[model samples]
Target: MSTSPHILLITPPLTQLNTPYPATAYIKGFLGGRGYTVTQADLGLELVLKLFSKEGLRRVFAEIEAGPYQLSDNARRMLRLKQSYLNTVEPVIRFLQNKDNTLASRICHSRFLPEASRFDNVADLETAFGTMGLSDQARHLATLYLEDLADLIKETVGPQFGFSRYAEKLAMSATTFDALHEALQAAPNLLDQMLLELADALMAKVQPDVVGFSVPFPGNLYGALRLAGRIKQISPATKTLMGGGYPNTELRTIQEPRFFDYIDFLTLDDGEGPWLRLLEAISCQLPVASCQNEQLADVVQNNLATGNRQLATHQLQRTFLRNALGEVEYHNSPQPDIPHAEVGTPDYSDLPLTEYLSVIEVLNPMHRLWSDGRWNKLTVAHGCYWKRCSFCDVTLDYISRYETAPSTLLVDRIEQIIAQTGQTGFHFVDEAAPPLALRDLAIELLKRRVTITWWGNIRFEKTFTPDLCRLLAASGCIAVSGGLEVASDRLLALMEKGVTIAQVARVTDGFTQAGIMVHAYLMYGFPTETAQETVDSLEVVRQLFAAGIVQSGYWHRFSMTAHSPVGKNPAKYQVAPVGPEPGPFAWNDLWHEDPTGTDHEAFGPGLAKALYNYLHGVALQEPLSFWFDFKTPRATVPRHLIQQALQEPGKPDAARPNNRLFWLGNTPELRYEAGKKGQQAVLTFFEQAEDFEVKVPAPLGPWLQTLLTSLASDYDTKVLLKDAAQSFPTAGGQKWEQFLLSAGWLTLREKGLLVL
Candidate 1:
């Protein structure tokens, strides 16, 4: 065997159907750039593609028929239409992938697809699809058809089958590994069998010396372990490693030796450092096949220490391995994590891009963006710039360790990703994309003339001025989602959100005014929040929707996690951590008694119903009590709170000397014409679909023309507003500030001029 081991990275099944999660792609890019052989795959998409094909449905039908389980009317109806399903499944798959658009009309009109239980309760077709094109309409129907089959699988052979998650219940806040371990020990279910088959085939093909699974969610934990177990059975020499969002938060204090029976190493926090160290430890003098868990720990502890000074004392940065004594041992190396800039562009090379299913499970515009199409996932920065939100896992490395790359470097990666994937869409998966970083990124994208459509998360800071929002939109930002968590000002301050209801209203209104979609993440439960506060928060959300400030929103029931501020010191928030008690395997989410809050659980259904109606443009005029079955406190918030907030005039711009000026519209054509007093300069500007003219005296015209031209130049120019003002011509004794209020200047400002 080669002295250097090849790496195979994978994203576990059922995280997403519309896009490949970026974890494996990121690792593959970083590791492969270091000249380490790396191959990556999205096993979820592969398993999905395999299970939903014509032949796959034949197998599914036959398997269900062979089984001895009671079938629901839906399942029975689907089974009866098995032939029709088998005939249309492949075509439906093709059409959903945008490979066969010709089938959309037939699917919509010809009864080409079998109607099943999933279609039984679909909302009015006209209301849902009236504005959507034919293709989108058909895609939603195909999505439901798949859901119908998914229901059959879950109800019969695979109770764990879900489009977005697998065995999630077993892993959600699973403090103990007993249930997960027991489930793993059982015989493979149908879905598990399919996953194993994919993994086995992959291992046989790659024969990699190391296999790493990126488990980004609780749903992925079981899938990762299940496949890692199979990898061990196939090749004990193949080192199995697991790390990601799940372990980063859940398995920090892992003490279960049984967990190591599945994977050789479990890494916490950022994986890049730990994986590099772990590899050095594994590539020891011991023969690869002979290096079992105990011997591997020995190699990590004894051999690697002598070989590498950074790994002295057998340290592996933030990693856990089973020791020779049949116990789990955590190891750490002092080596810092690989810097964000140094980690190369995420490689989407080995992933089956076109094969990913773009399923539409939701009808709301902003919500459907998650499931509608592929978006090249990128990061604006390494971590959250504002990591002070009490409810957030701000203490975790992913949030706490903030870092940013240069704007040019970020755009360089963007171009590289677009070139590779042939996709111009991006989703910056940052904790909260820093506002200043996004500004620079947007400017860089414009300067480089990189055309792309993108969106990401951000904090509702006042820095997102209307002008700045327009600047972002000009650079192709389509939508942004941010936390409007606990809209009550008191609770917001308690959570350290650094924003109030009025501030969110202004910022979201700014984004909306700039023609960008805004989605708000709202929270219901918080310490010291009363029922009246809950009602008021709902009222605020309702007005936000009614006033068209926030286009979409989601209300989350607050769950305290161990890494968050509140979870760490519950007493400070006037809450008690009534926990299952931290156990050996998984422990992050802490059950807390928010003694001062209302019955949070009781509001979940009403909140969901109200939000659902609001999303669909329904029931906004109904009383807040209409959503809740029980009597609720009357709204303390005013009827037009958001309207009044929106009506409030924005503060005048402060033209700081260093503030940059640029033109986002097309270059203007300057000409001279007759004026009342003298020759007038007329600058004709062309926007996307319209053209307008700005007139000024000839002398002032040339000066303004030159400034606008320089600002709009293809090169990345730094024409500060102060610099432009200082260079103003003394035409008719018009002051620089006076000229700013002129119709010509105002028109230019309205037509895409940005002073940011």
Candidate 2:
């Protein structure tokens, strides 16, 4: 057997999909590179799949019948259809898994699958989108079927149940350790029972020396701790560690002694460096002095003075360790941050890929991307390139410090991922992909001849030119989504987004023209945003859709985060901090009251309703005041603002060169040949640009070559055409010019310009 200690990395319950979150994969890749044995599990997806099964539903119904809990009307109705649900749950699951095509016909034809009050609006959705095909309808209905079962579990077992988040409300905005402690101490719910049973099987299988739990969200906290608590109870000698987004953010200032009872160590920031140091300490390779921080050394000396003999010899830097006195002590690490290029490609070899279920929750076009298919999640960089947004977590290292790997290395990692997972789709989970980096990546991908579909987040800035968008599309970019937060020029400038509404319209239009789908991340209710601004923002959104620059968008209410610029200086934004002021457990999303006195809260429903209708191509001509129920001021925005902005005026007599030939992977060639029928004119257009070649009039061939060469020289069309007038006869030049204009050989920038 290898001497290296076994490590088991786990993802807790309630993160969406069967795919493991990228955190475990990152740590696993790093540790594997360091020559240690690592095993990983995605318990979140496993538990969800296990619970939604026919047998699981049977057990759930039995628990519901046996328990003393009160049932909601929906839960009571589900009990009445218990037998039908038990019969159909397995088929629905198999259909979702793509294992049974025969069941699709049946599912589409009959109402055999049970529905719930949660799905009472399915009819409304169908009516709104028009009658979709049976496959889509079945998928929607099947989603509702699973949701109905989930609802029964929620109403009877745990009130905080959700497909992706369980007991989230209990953890959200939790200020003190006492709330989490009491929640952990509460009687186990049905979901908890299922998680414990799953954990029991996994622990028995892996039997790891060190079990690390990855808690990426507040909702995952309760589940992770509960699992750790069970591991401590069953196997007291096994060391338990917790780290990820939640602990990295919330547990940084933790002082709770009870929190360390189940977990021996809690790491912060990027887990790779700390994990290696921890393993070294555990293996007795790290010297005592090297492993110790001043605070931790003081705790250790104090414990020794108290005559404690059970203290472990292991010590860790950059981690919270438990001493003999049962107190958690933080140790600072002297290690420098690891370069992102050296972190290695995320490994997914240990995850079960085929078992993941693709869930469809909403019929909305924009919402389906979340649950539609499996996407390989990779980060293009370590942090945001533009971290100056006032509402963002600019103080956090994950956002503040931007670092990126070389384009060649990124493509190499992409190839490695394709070889490992046999999947060619990717989702770059970056805060905002830097434009220069994306351009370099697109070029490298083309040079390497790598074919993979990908999309990611970006800032709506001018760097994404029409040429760059087309190049990206040629390199297999299918869609892009970016923040267009608060859509008011004044608020945008205040937020330091670095892009105005006009710039956003132009950028989105570029993407659209390149045949890439566009989705906007919209925000409302920023500090000092009056009712008039909100209405005007909606007006701009309406024009963006009407002009067909953006196909989809989402509206989120502005939130104050602890690490944001606004949070650091509240008075700057004319807001005062409210209660739940930074405590030990959670330090995110600080509540604040805006002195501007606008009811930002009430704007959410109307904005959402209006955007929803806009997405479905409805009510575009309605007045801005139609969305809001309460009397709102009329929008002061000019109706033609977005249209004029999107129709950007070009320099007089200027022609923007189309890079389509470059994207097609070849150069154009023209040939003139005399035929046997008495010097007949023939022009042959041949190259590897596409699969086919075309023949044009011979008279047009020389003019086309001249235009292409002129475009390469970057000369304006007026200047080039004036030069061309001296070379060809008037009649021949006119015919060739008409052909070039009509055949898309020459593009004029001024004809379609919209004037406001």
Candidate 3:
């Protein structure tokens, strides 16, 4: 070896239970090829388990016994309520209770925490942190949820320190840890001792040149900073770098240089470029500023300030990043392509990869999806094309950062994996696999006759025709996942989602016809969504399912992410500001609301349950292919029976809530194998398809009528409407009203429609 100096790459645990998968592997590949010995540590997960380890638990229990900051019975009750998800996240709960990290169970606990209620308000967070006595950094970090902790680190530390480099997301994970923290009190000194012990172990064994900490989420922030401090205490000479999501977004406002005492460098933007540059500078004994120069600093500043807007709309003003000397900077070059192939096979040997958590061996959503066989995960592309969906975070990394790997390169990677693992199935982990790349990939797979099964995310566009879908299916493609954010056309337009509802229906039908499974992403509670509009969304879901288009769906409450288009331009989507106390990721939904005080009830539990029922097949009027594919049971009498049960001129609400067709077999106690309790439980029909069926959800019937009527009202002069001159009377009045409502012509006040 040339003694060229080695670097360690670390992915801080975004969630307590998640491991660093793609991040460590990809970074190892890039740096290892460049003569840098890179070591990655998933300290986030380690710390999470440490919290519940025997030692960890002893410390926590001791603290509770001592009663730090007056944590009374009420506080304990609240904490217990938060941790009520113990049954679901048993591994993590037990691990936390143990509070020891040396054990294998602790390590396993790092990969799976039960997800539940997120922090709601700044006060709620203040109370949480207050109970724990967290320092300022930890307090600030509590704002982010577990899923995004890594990215938050990148945003906060990287930008705050002024290291203006960008790298692609080497990893993608969806694990969250807040639910586990619900029952625990933050004990800073106890956590510090555990981290010190872990750090000492690393120094004794690995003797790594530099130890990097990946604190990607807010929940992990206190733990990350504490761990970073402990690492330094153990090995003073070993350099420490903090990167990931936290530093990327919040770095701009964090002015305290004291935070840098433990962290030598903070990587901003994408870690791949900046991290490599920082390593070179450190190894070569060059001034850190020389790596960024001045021009690049300016561009980095502007880019960080404006995010994707700088890349998409205003790059012409400064095409090349410039420094103080007016020299162009290339350190941050190749600003992450969303559709690129692996530069090389991820170096997983160094990581405790096999030792990390595996969901497949057990039963989970991922396992259920792969019940036929196990499959490896791979990314065909990165970034997104239709990043224009206002709800997306295209701006944070810069929109237009679209890139696709060559078909040859992708195939090579797949072949190498198949050969190595003796597995033929792969998961394409792209944000939205570009249409052209998908087509090219299909063509190449066919040409090479690579008999590998795969599935990935893609945009719901017209380009995915029946023939194309068929070709993909023939080429071992199994499922298609894409976001259909809202069912209302007006809301869709407001979000700048280019695809139309009709097009979505057609494309979904095409995928279904081609035997491709589809899992749609649905969002409720956008800024402009009125009570009727929200209801109308359910109607659209009902139609999509009844039409045999959608196979299944993942419904989410709409969130204005810090870097997404909608988050940046809230006014465009009618989002008004709530009081400005930052809380948790879930609080993003609370930012927007109706100021007129007319439709807040639309956001209540009823609509949420109604939509949940529909998505889970509890409210289905007809059995779609998705229900059978998921092996979900029908719970109540079929639609025909329900219709028969409905007496003429009678309302359905008169029936008992749980006795309704949708809730027949579904009880509060039911849970999914994924440990996703209420969220994942499906409404099953007991025996015959006719024994349980759902009605056309209340939202759709009304919204459809509104949309049509609004269309007629808007274009009345252009079309000859016989009813425009007088009171419109006909059997289709309700249909017209549904269309009109969805079309945005009538309001609740004007139509005098009762709120559901």
Candidate 4:
């Protein structure tokens, strides 16, 4: 190896539209600490920028001419619209909330939209500019609009809208390829041409010695491969390394050696330690046997089995580490062969710190839940705990366990980060937020008076006793997000969520009492969920609200992820494959084909409105305080209309009703309906309304009718929310219902229906 060869670190793009922690920064921080000259380039954000460029568009458009590009206008429009829609952040979030497998499957297919990408060999400038496809004027217009908007943004927001060197590379690996594919199909090989142009700019403007690409998402696997192929072709001398989520997760399954031919080398695990070692070897012209081919096979096998395994401590030490407070351990440590105490703190000097600030509009979204009012994303602690969750891909990239540093070590890392970057807040990007680690963290933070704000994911456990929660809050813990999965005890048992409804209620209450905001990560559409169970889950949530135990919430449908426990063992979960497999689940339909699948109706069925209503905090507007408020008419609303207003946005005000015409028409006495006493419940609610007529928009009548129809359909049988076609909005069913009730349009006593 040439003495002191220049090394380039790249971070693949991620889902974050704003700035995200770069892979290279972690590596570069490690390498730089070891006295190596490392430069970072984020290709992910660059890909997004390319989407806005004329040169990028023209090249892809031209390429379409050389291919079999027959597609319907609707499909093309869908493609273009999806691309544009991706510019915003909501679609991705909304997509994640949907549970319909049929819709998800169609979306998965559409990810390979036009199917033209496979035809172009290298997917390079020549291929991109030579393909044959229809003239996509709409795609062109979109490109122009985005570009103009980007320009205005740059001018108004300065570099804040751009990506850091590390963030750029991350985006390139994470999102660019997909974005390119969408653009290319709509036009031509715009993705390739854009890369070529960017390569030139980098070569001319930055003149870096090496170029690495981080490939994080499996959806981006193909595009990343093609982009790497093109980059290698353009600059033969520039070293190309492939790392990130793909290699880390797929290390074991990499049967094709040809991938090695395209990229010079592959890095895995945390990459920081290995990366630092490689840089040192290169800098000193040392023959490093560790990174050689003979050892690669073993590395691959171990990584694949471990799935997102963490780096060894010896590996960590080879890079850099600093600051220590407590001991660290790995739960399911992948590299037991490695030590932890020896690893050094990562170096941050080699990264382009300024670039990250441009795109950071606000701190990470989760930070908003914290009372400390600080912004932070995650650092280290990458994978999840309980990787074996039925629906989770535990055996996938970065989901495996790593050696966790002691609380002292964590504090040290945070202190170092604060000194170097002045980032005082943090978001521990963990899967389960293990109780032991939290206990240790609280001890350390309290001891050191870290004076920083933080938040993270946690499982609902009795360990979150009132005392522990109170201590956590005092130690700068602002909020905790728990994946309650489902509210039904039976469903919870089936999914192995480990927490009971009672436990959930208690834990949530504990957090709330401690004054920490609670954001619940709920899942509906579990394979065996029945209609009654779905409604029961809603009731549970209502109970939680009544108890004043939860502050905020988010929900998702159960998805069978690739390599996940459930995905691997579908039958164990009573989930039979009723349709084709779904694409990689993204908050948005990143790789989806039919944005709206043909079988979309089948996915929502009868539960769509209910699901939607539940998420928006309106399902059964009875807050945990509902009991106390019920007596005073403070927590009630016209429950029927809540579902209607949510689905039909800005519904014509014409639906305004004649409040005087409607009333709680009552018969002599309340009567219970068989075992359930359903009729009596209605009578009690009507009596509470005190002859008040509920006024709702005329358009909502249909929604009420549909809800009643679904309820009747379920009658005595347990109908899972998954089986229903419609989901209700939380805002509509909960908040709006409360509004009407509080407005005295509905009452609790008249029908004996109001439980509160």
Give each model's whole-structure lDDT.
Answer: 0.86, 0.76, 0.49, 0.47
Angstrom error of the Cα, residue 14, model 4: value is 4.8
Error at 503, model 1, angstroms: 1.1
lDDT (Cα, tens digit) per residue for candidate 1, span 28-135: 888778777899999888988999998788888989999998998888999999999999999989988888989888977778899888888877767778856777
- Clashes per model (N, Cα, C within 3 A): 0, 0, 94, 132
Runs of candidate 3 exceeding 4 Å displacement: 14-20, 44-195, 286-343, 358-377, 418-425, 449-451, 578-604, 621-756
Per-residue error (Å), model 3, residue 233: 1.4
Residues 279-364, candidate 4: write the lDDT tens digits. 43332222222333233335434554555333333322212211132222211213332233334554455443333312212122
Best-performing candidate as measured by TM-score? 1
Ranking by TM-score: 1, 2, 3, 4
Residue 294 lDDT (model 2): 44
TM-score, candidate number 4: 0.54
Off by over 4 Å in 4: 1-4, 46-195, 204-210, 219-223, 256-261, 272-388, 395-402, 545-547, 576-756
Better of 2 and 4 by TM-score: 2
**Can you write out model 2's per-residue Cα lDDT over 1-756, one digit (the tens) per residue?**
115468999888778763557889888888888788899988888888778787888888898899898887888898999999889887787777767756766776767777778677665544644565656667777888888887778778767778787777777887777877887888877778888999999889989878999988988888888999999988887889999888776777777788887788899888887887677555432122222334345544544466442333344446887677777688865767778999988989788877776667875665666676677889889989889999998888788778999999999999998999988888888989988788778767867789999888999898787767877887788888999988899999999999999999999998999888888999887998898898899999999988888988999888887778998898999988896766766667688898795898888999998998888789999987888889999889998999888777633222432222232323345666664533323323344343333334456556645544444343123334335434544434345345445433332221111110
Candidate 2's TM-score: 0.87
lDDT minimum window of 10 residues, candidate 3 = 659-668
Q: What is the lDDT of residue 546 in candidate 2?
A: 89
